[model samples]
Target chain A: MVKKEKDASTEQRILDAAKQVFVSKGMAGARMQDIADGAGINKAMLHYYFRSKEQLFEIIFRDSIGRFVPKVKALITSELSLYEKIEQFCDGYISMALENPYIPMFVLNELHKQPDAFVRKMFNNELPDLSKLVQQIDEEIKKGNIKPISPVQLIMNMMSLCVFPFLAKPIFSILMGLDELQFRNSIEQRKKAVPQFIMDSIKR
Target chain B: MVKKEKDASTEQRILDAAKQVFVSKGMAGARMQDIADGAGINKAMLHYYFRSKEQLFEIIFRDSIGRFVPKVKALITSELSLYEKIEQFCDGYISMALENPYIPMFVLNELHKQPDAFVRKMFNNELPDLSKLVQQIDEEIKKGNIKPISPVQLIMNMMSLCVFPFLAKPIFSILMGLDELQFRNSIEQRKKAVPQFIMDSIKR
Candidate 1:
């Protein structure tokens, strides 16, 4: 049991190092030597544990997507009102992204290279059905609580409002002439403001 | 002059081919040989024109950002009402991005790799001042025309709602079980609906 635990720790160390490097450099640019160096392990050990870079990347990508999906799913599945759910989603999505800002870019970048494989894996594994959230939007529309809009459009609007800030941070900061502190504070402010904005638009 | 025209066409071809390869593979993954093949030019000609992959990528990145910034600046500098500006921004941003869907992800992914460099280049070029938009938001708030919200937060929300859908297209398509037709329609719908949503929330 002690030996097994030690093996797991070493594997995790390799994964953490690979995640950092892969997220920054991506698949084709990342080298086995660099991952080995980052993990404080020898090249032979890296191959022994993961066998290949592709395998290691797949593991990390899966784990990253898995981490993001549940929080998003929680927002969709919650019993909160449509307004409350929008708030929860905006807050939760941004916070989750803040913790791992690189993951979205990493996933999207890799998927651009291997769309069929990544899309299949994502659908087969991580994403939850948003039909419930869609149903909620429809109900709201029917009740005349919100303007007439498709569930997909409404959900996409809510998501775009929440995620684009982080995705466009570089452009936003440069265009606005904000430094790191100001940029972060601006994001923090959005935590409350985005939900309210969404609620205002949709709530009758 | 004839020789100069030939040189210009060659440079244009390389840039166009490089944009396609770079946007798909990113900087780290793209190879000189691949770019040469894409451009239907020999590797020596590619070297003669651009010298290196980095040079080629810089040209593409600068051009892509330039294309986006002008429209954004126009929206900012316009004399339209706050609500009208949001509508125009949604229309302009989405249309530009759809015409070049790869650009937002390409700029964003590269920015993650070298944020300081991206910021410097972005700011060295023309960009819009948000003071006008900020003043508009402040006026709206003072009159209680909309909920009191920071203009920065409002901008972030507007961007998030507008941009995230394109950035997360694969994940969204998977989660929503949307076929390509449905997904395309959804985007088209948001081009109209997003502005209305933002207007509904903020209009008195």
Candidate 2:
């Protein structure tokens, strides 16, 4: 039992270190040696654990996507009003993103680099069904709780508001002349404020 | 005059090709040879026109940022009603982004790669001021024209909704199972619907 726990801990350490390197350097630029260095292991240990760079990246990427997609799916299916869902989504996504700001950019950059491979992999993975959320939006519109609008638009809007800040962090920080702490504080402020702003704009 | 016109045309061609390559491949992955190939020019001619890859990239990046900032500034300072301004901003931003689906991602990726350099260039270029927009939002709130909210939050939300789709095209396409046409149509729909959505949520 102890040995199993130790192996699990070491594997997690490699994953964490690999994620950091991959996020910063991207696939082409990241090196196994660097990941090994970051994980405080030798290259042989890295190979012993993950076998190859591609395998390691796939594991990290899938792990990152898994973390993000399930929460979004849960938001879609939750027993909340549309207004409440928007609020939940904004707060939840921003908070989650704050903890993993690099994930969106990392996923996006790789997707741009290898669209076919990334898309196929993502699709093969179980993703959230947005159709249910769409139906909910339609019902809300039909019931006169909100104005008529496509759920896709709402989803896009909600997601954009939630994710763009992290994706554009460097430019946003530069444009706003914010340091790391200041940038983080701004995002924290947006956590509550963005949802309120969205609700204010959309509620009947 | 003829020579000047020809030079202008060549420069425009180079810019267009550069935009396509840079947007698709990103800065690190993009090469001058590929850009020249895309433009149907020889490598020496490409260099003669733009001096270096960095110089060529700067032209496109600056031009893109210039196109984006002014329209947003107009949203803030225009004589339209608060609701009208919001609609106009959403419509304009979505339209522009959809047309150049790769611009946001390209700019964002480069910004991440070289934050300080990009930010300094943008700052030195005199980005649009949001002070007037802030004041306008304050006035709107005082008169109860819209829900009371921070202008910064409002602006960020507006931008986030408009920009995130293009930024996350790969993931969104996979998650939603949208082909290029469906994705394009969805954006077109957003152009018309986003303003109303925003108005519905915010207007008392």
Candidate 3:
């Protein structure tokens, strides 16, 4: 392989490894040596690639926000009606979360630890533009398509329904005596249940 | 004050300080010195009281579980009707969480870090007795009093709706440009909105 190709492969490996360590151990507990080991590279390569854990975490955090927010923006702003959007979001998000269970907690924990970086990445240019979704909800209310509820409250409900299960899975697993498959099965149940639940509450 | 009273005061102060530090900084980032400083006692007194950070954290963690689980147990297992239980849970849990914003994340994060401990404290007696509540939902469904739904799914929905906002508050605050009072007003909205949402979803 060419030297440039090898360099790209190594960089990708380092990022994947760093993301795993950061997600599992969190920002405070994760160590550079751990990331280097996970990546199958020496300390020198890890340092040469990212310089500091903060810099590497910034990359991962930025990438997570990039992957999550824009899709949400697109879905809400798309031509689909609000009910269709809710159904699609519930189905798609649960499936996505089942595959990438770490993202919800990792992003929230890191954001809790450091909000400034996330705000900078997500706040400007209406990149996320939640106001737009709020506006959409308002328009729906105007048409008497849904109950007269606060848009922000509706947004909060949609988010909580979709996101909370992923973070709370382990706790409930222990509480409910659920094995891994059982928990995932319950999550699968939400694919239909959540959308139905939301539509039931909001439909006029 | 007597020596016993004085010692008790210092211990209480230490516990309060440690709880705050653990909640804000998490298990990995919190320091003994910070707890000591916050408690207004030197490291020596702190050591005399708790011996080690692990011991101190264990006390605080167990205290938290003791305070939280028993109340929920009583509320759910009480003679209240299924619908009343949901309404009470939404109303009471939100109000409690609003007052003690730190506990949910702190218990969750610490539980994430060390499940063995939380499990040991909370696992038996069905001390929290979630199955009883699940059974209550099952009976309601059987009697055709409420729409058919999996008890587990319903529980997950209620938990998500009530808990996610506290963890996500800062991120949303920045996103929505909501100051503390406004954010609080939105939470107040949930006191009614969440109960209404949950009831609407489940009522036949």
TM-score of each: 0.81, 0.79, 0.86
CAPRI quality level assigned to candidate 3 from its DockQ score: medium
- Sorted on lDDT, highest at the top, how do the candidates line up? 3, 1, 2
Best-matching candidate per lDDT: 3
Chain B, candidate 1: TM-score: 0.83
Every candidate's lDDT: 0.78, 0.76, 0.81
Per residue, candidate 2 scores C-alpha lDDT tens digits across B24-100 of 78877788888888778878978888888888888887777767676666566677777777788878877778777
Candidate 2, DockQ score (0 to 1): 0.51
10 residues in a row with least lDDT, candidate 3 chain A: A118-127
Q: Which has the better TM-score: candidate 1, or candidate 3?
A: 3
- By TM-score, the candidates rank as 3, 1, 2
For each candidate, what's the DockQ?
A: 0.59, 0.51, 0.63
List, residue by residue over A1-204, the lDDT tens digit for candidate 1: 144674458888899889878876677777888888988989999888887888988888777777666666676788888888888877877787777776766767767887767766765655566778788888888988888877777777777776777767777887678898898888777788777777777776
Docking quality of model 1: it rates as medium
Score candidate 2 by lDDT.
Answer: 0.76
Superposition error at B27 for model 2 (Å): 0.9
lDDT of 1 at B108: 74
Candidate 1 collision pairs: A160-B160, A160-B161, A161-B160, A161-B161
User: Top model by DockQ, which number?
Assistant: 3
